[model samples]
Target: ARRRLYPKPFPGIPYNKVSANRIAGDLPELIPVIKATNEYSTSMFAISTQRLRLPLAQDPREIEDILVRRGREFDRAPMSIKTLKNFFPYSFMGKYNTPEVKEQKRIWADAFGADFLRKVAAPSIYNATLDLADGRPFEVVEDLHNATLDAIWVALVGEEAGITRHEIKKFLQSQRDASDGGRRDPGPPPRGYLLRREVDYVSEMIAKNSSSGIPVLAQKLAAYLPRHRQFRRTVDTEIGLVMRKAVDRFQRLELGRLEAGENDTCMMDLVLRRKVLEAKKLGRPLMDPTKDKVLLDDTFLMMFASYPTAQTELRAALKVAFPHPTTPSVDELLGADIPYLDAACEESLRLAGVAKGNLRQTVVDTHIMGHFVPKGAEIFMNYHVDHAPYPVDEEKRSASSQAAGAKLAAREGISRGDVSRDLGSFEPRRWLVKDEKTGQEVFDAYALPQLAFGGGYRGCSGRKLAVMEFRTVVALLVLNLEFLELPEEMKTLKASETIFRLPDMPFASLRAL
Candidate 1:
């Protein structure tokens, strides 16, 4: 039992030998690192002897190969699926590279494709951000969340969710009611405000599942607790809400209430249209979102994952925006001609590091960096290697890994360039270069390592949408308002380890331009 409980390392990789003795495994050593950095990736080698024998890879080349090149050998890790599946079983995040998942990805790709983003989503995001220009003091994170949620809601549901607007109006009315109209406090609701039903549901789900150390177990045992019971109720209610919306949309299209011809208004409409076409092609009945678990789950996942990622990136972008003495105008921003804005957004993604790392499971006997890894072993690729200074013991690496690294190093003209310098600094200009032929500065994404969204075929599906939202919000905010320097108390870089690394206190003061 003891031998089974405390296992040894998988022979060819580096791990803390001391960690193999304890039943808790490397958790004792890992806790401090997580508390200090709020990230799972570390400068130290990973030590795990718990349920899964895990290995951490820090070298960029090895990490890139695992994510991009060796798909047949590695799949999304079970640890990740275990946590995410409890909350989103039908979402792609919880599934392997199955045919159904591929189809879902295709649908999601179309939903967030270039045409949909530029034509259908951009205007909604723009209008949503316009609400942020109110010179009143607001919590940066909360307000950004509201705006992002509203934007995504419009894109998903084809109506003004009005979350941001509703909150702003509620705050103003409460101020009037409280006779505190003269005093504009620069924090969250001084007392507290009622959360929208949808916001409450989403918040509770993320908070419960992401914060728990053992999400799957917690979910299974949740029925015994009151708060967990409430969570279950909330989840059911939200599911019902989603089902009703889907049914309404399908009924409208069927009854001819909604003008046909590719109801290009929102994702829900687009999905209904696609299903209708597919049904026609197959000579079958239309699939209902209420009955189709994939449709329902993916729709909910769209709303769940959309805003948080953008909100985290936006907070980071706000920190780096308008660093220059002169800021650009709204016209310049809207024209999409500014390379600095693009650079700043990319820099923010790197600095913020919302997704600290990615996890993959070995599907068969394989070697990472020349180290032998067996099937079902978990490999974690930390993004810190992209920017942070970490020790690399070349002697510990496998011969094949060394040879690959040498080959990569010898490649002419392939370099990180400015990104290799000032590893800790936020210099957006590092991503900009002069186009020799045009004599104009353009954003060069390849100049730096971009693992923020991961890579390969399974990379983040929402990368385009996230970047578009970040750029739009950052550009508009920089163009129309001045972000006052945050006080020391409000400027802590420490973040909570949630679904994303959310800044604990993302507060800011804005002055309308």
Candidate 2:
């Protein structure tokens, strides 16, 4: 049994010999530790201990095989989102592979489908960017989040809803309350804060109940923790408000459409109308519209995931956007001829590494990459590890060749040292190149195209909407704004790792066009 369960750890110190925490605190480069200990191992490894097994599908082929080919054989780690239930006793995030989840996913996918999203959001996004032409330096993250919040909320949530009018302060404050065990004061949130419902909704869900032991079990026990008590209040209050507002607006829209014989669809209206139909057939009173569970829950899930991922990608794009050589004008960027801008978006997501990986579970005992993974074991499908760019071919990087080049340069009166381009650097041009002969646009696909958005059947449902929003918003901002490099002092910004990689407190500023 021990042999079957452990399958020999991937050549690392025994769990008892060294601690994961100590290694994190004491070691500056844990990647070196991984390289040394798990040197040649691939696919799966216990790394530290039998109880701490981590399956790494590092190769793109293996990633495709697992996440795409054999995706059904696995499920997202069951406990990965169990903590979400504290907010909605039945958060669809905590449940998976059910008919309800499927139904909700279908609805969400349709609502965020490319056509539906663009029709609703294109004009607003264009106008939002144009609004930023004041030339004063403003916080880019804050502005982006606010604009993203409004765009999504108005399009998906309600026609009248706007980000500035939403209780943005409450959500941000609530998130702080939830994560820190209510250690911070439960102070009153400011009114009319920007980035309201969308921000708070996701933030509260993000707060993990404190624990040091096995994460799955620790999270399971997190809700009963005292800190969650305060956080729950924030969640309950906001859920009530969002649900009330969504339902109220949905009814009015449906009534108007029916009366005027018009065919219009807002996101929530579809779900509500479906519920009403189900109720009429089943002889029940539309069964607590919000209690359909998946409808509201899934909206929250998509919004929660969508907004932050958009923020990360947008912020990353801002870092590379122009007041410089790579800049394009509004017409040029929007004209569909800008391959470099498109490549820049892709590269930004890859480098941001926002979602490092997903945690999946082996549904039954299975064999992968020659390792025996038993039923219920966890698999860490790491995007960061699998998305690595390969080292430069040594033959092309020979020391003799480099020395000769240096000598040639010296003789030419430009004594520059051998320039080694870091393959791992953020090079947007990796995605495209100008054709040498015809100068036509051509794709120079990354050697290993980044799967920052997980690749598989369970690929992001919100991806279409996210793409549209990111492309439109980032491009508009880039066309008009400039992101200044941070001062050395401000550069001290630390990243707070979560399900997403978030800047702890980024102070990036943007100037108007």
Q: Which regions of candidate 1 fall more than 4 Å away from where they truly are?
A: 32-52, 178-215, 223-262, 310-335, 384-386, 389-417
Stretches off by above 4 angstroms in model 2 are: 1-51, 124-134, 159-211, 225-266, 277-284, 310-337, 385-423, 433-439, 442-447, 485-494
Give the Å shift of residue 401 in candidate 1.
Answer: 9.5
The weakest ten consecutive residues by lDDT in model 2 span: 37-46
TM-score of each: 0.81, 0.67
lDDT by residue (tens digit), candidate 2, 1-513: 433533333333233323233423212333344344322121123232232444454444355456655766777676565655644555555665677666656655656666655554455544444444334454556656666666665555545334332334445566788888675443543322323643564464353321233444556565577665655454445444666655555455444354332233355555555555455556676556545555555655655666665333444444454436544444444445445666677776766666666667888877665556678776666565323433433334324334543544444212222222453466665666556566565444333435677766577766666666667666766555667666777764234444465665668666554
Clashing pairs in 2: 168-196, 171-200
Clashes of each: 0, 2
The digit string of per-residue lDDT tens for model 1 on 164-283 reads 776787788777768954655434531112223444464465546543445467655654567645644554455546556655655555434433535577766666666765666567
Candidate with maximal lDDT = 1
- Indicate the residue-level lDDT of 192 in model 2: 20
Candidate lDDT (C-alpha), each: 0.65, 0.52
